[model samples]
Target: MSRHRTIFRRPILLCVDFDETITVHDTTSLLFQLSSSSASTQQQLVTQYVDEVGEFIGSYETKWRQRELISSRSRTFDDAGLHEFLEGYAAVDLRSVQRVVECRALEGIRHQDLVKVASSVQVRSNYAETLALADDWKIISVNWNKKLVESVITQAGVVHEPTQIIANDMKADQQGVTTGEINVKVQSPMDKARWIDNVRSMYAATKPTVVYVGDSATDLLALLAADVGIWIAAANTAASSAKLLHQLVENYGIDLHPLMNCGSVGGRIHNDRPVLYTVTDWAQVQSILKSPF
Candidate 1:
């Protein structure tokens, strides 16, 4: 399943989104589970997260309708507009992180505690199999703690370790207790795109082909930045994450093409008309990446 750089003329760089993309469930709740807070306190934190996100979505929907009405006369997919639209989500995302800090939800949690919660996180079906095809693997996420992402992947029996993880760090004391202050780095879709470019730069000499697989709105920018973008709508979460993705695609008229065969990978960014391949499961991803596409 390994790729030979000499024969391929370039390496394969697989960048996957964490949370609902790789895992069966988003790890946001798992982060809270690390804290020894009473069940009621933990529920309060989770409820806050849900309320804020819901409010943001409500506002976003209003704006979405206005845009739809504005474009009713002539409708064509505006790739650049879609990029701008998703970038605006950064503020809401950052606000959520700030609220978590203010509430001290993660404070007092130890690193080892995170490892315990990570063990319960489940990887999507066939994800590890598809991951083995890459010359290098990286997890790009907006999740508050990087260690949780690493631990989850390690526990999932993934033999190929992630070369890099682009995510926020949880500040911890010498005694390993979380300070509740996140050293925020990745928060926006733009941030994800920037980090992916940083990773791609490391392989400038090889000119590796970059493939990004993601599931939510936060992953939109990074998906477009790669040579091949895969939107895996998890069966369990399709009603929410998948619906949001579909709404964005529909509202903006995105050029989403169904991936039918193995040789569907693009060579470079299709700026003129960006195309994102859609998939329902990791087995499809494995089939697509079994050979060069």
Candidate 2:
């Protein structure tokens, strides 16, 4: 039995990331692991994904540092700069998806295969306990397959199943087998942020308190848009583990506060600079949710 309750005056909309934030492992990578491709091809697909993403990060950092040196000042992470940087990632994401399709890595997987994979990927502790605190819960992700995400949530027995799942779709053949072609919808950080805005607009009349929880750069923009943004990380990891995230926040002039320190929405929106809360686990999240907001 879980203590399920909400203390907010207005309606609450909780948006969460589906990857490492909710699941114990990244299910997208697991999709390749479960591919019907030969062992060697599977290894190659995994390696290619890592290499390309690594190269992109390395190149971006090098270019950014060079520009900083030439300018003699750190770049301010304003709206325009942030949007440009995030939107530019759409191409990188598309290339990765295209590679998966061209190689036919996930071509033969079926819904049952996804369900089996979802069983192996565990949700964080107290996830359901915390879900009870929200009026509506939705998952906003850049994951390639929506069914895979739904499988994970259904297995977790969340208090409230997501009213909607905003993600990409996989093209299936006449026989219902994956065709290796993915329709890219939420492809970048910018896309995730826009979806958050779209959700907020739906509840504009009630002015719902929106809380976004996530674990990576893809979740950054959406987290910023929420009334309460929580960054969940490994309990043993140091602050330096999120160097890129810290750099972006510091440069952009956003303030990071401990989740336990946050009380009401008033404190979060008191200034021009946005406030993002950090937590190591869901227990900390439960504490805030248990209180009246």
Candidate 3:
């Protein structure tokens, strides 16, 4: 459970990324494997979706790199058209793969198996254990499958409203296979921020503060859009959130501690940079939120 330092007087909306921010491994990848397809074939499809399609989901590369590649194809291409093409291609690929997986349905995987997968995979410590306490935190799944993300978190016994999770998904059968047409909601990183803004407008009267947490560059736009943006760098990895923020701060020439509401919030702002916070795990994040200690 997240340690409570002090009670919040205003509504707090946590806009979080689902892929690697909460779960240790990518649940989308795991969902693809459950249709009884061979491991190699599953990996091939996932690889194509990430590499040839979504620019590895903006992990090793940036969104600008994706635009550069697109611009190379046709300098005169329309921006809106390119965006649509990329998103459409991913949706088609994902649906096509789901169809193929359903055709096989030889795994005999039951819904119970999803719980096992959730347990087998190492979560970020108490991250899943502290969900309900987050109130209206939304899981912005940038990946292709929402059901898979929901399944893992649901199996964790973290009860949350349906509106809290935004992602793509397909209906599942008794065999634990995707048996319906895919529903694509969020296709790009920009969509994450856009959705949050939309949600904010819905609860505008409350004047909630949006706190976005994510792990990859795919979450760049949303993180920057929030009142408080957090980067959850992989543990012991060189791509620590602090390092990434340092780079962004240097590149954008922005200060850490902005002039407005500077010291009233939780966590410390080093040398007056951005109102950014970096924690090794979810527990620390909860700790930082409750108090400035």
Q: Which candidate achieves the best lDDT against the true structure?
A: 1
lDDT of 3 by residue, 43-145 (tens): 6655654454444334323644565565532223233533443355446455655644555432434455555666655567677644544546888876655
lDDT of each: 0.77, 0.75, 0.59
Total clashing pairs in model 1 = 0
lDDT of 1 by residue, 50-153 (tens): 77667867776887888768674215666666776676566766766777788777787888888887877877888877888778788888888988888887
Off by over 4 Å in 1: 1-9, 37-49, 63-75, 159-163, 236-238, 261-263, 267-272
Q: Give the range of the ten consecutive residues with the poorest summed lDDT in model 2.
A: 235-244
Ordering by lDDT: 1, 2, 3
lDDT comparing candidate 2 with the true structure = 0.75
**Which residues of candidate 3, in runs, are more than 4 Å off?**
1-8, 47-116, 129-135, 171-176, 239-275
Cα displacement (Å) at residue 42, model 2? 3.7
The predicted structure with the larger TM-score, 1 or 2, is: 1
Cand. 3 TM to true fold? 0.65
* lDDT for position 12 in model 1: 81
Return the TM-score for candidate 1, rounded to 2 decimals. Answer: 0.86
Model 2 ranges with Cα > 4 A deviation: 1-8, 63-77, 159-163, 236-241, 263-265, 268-272
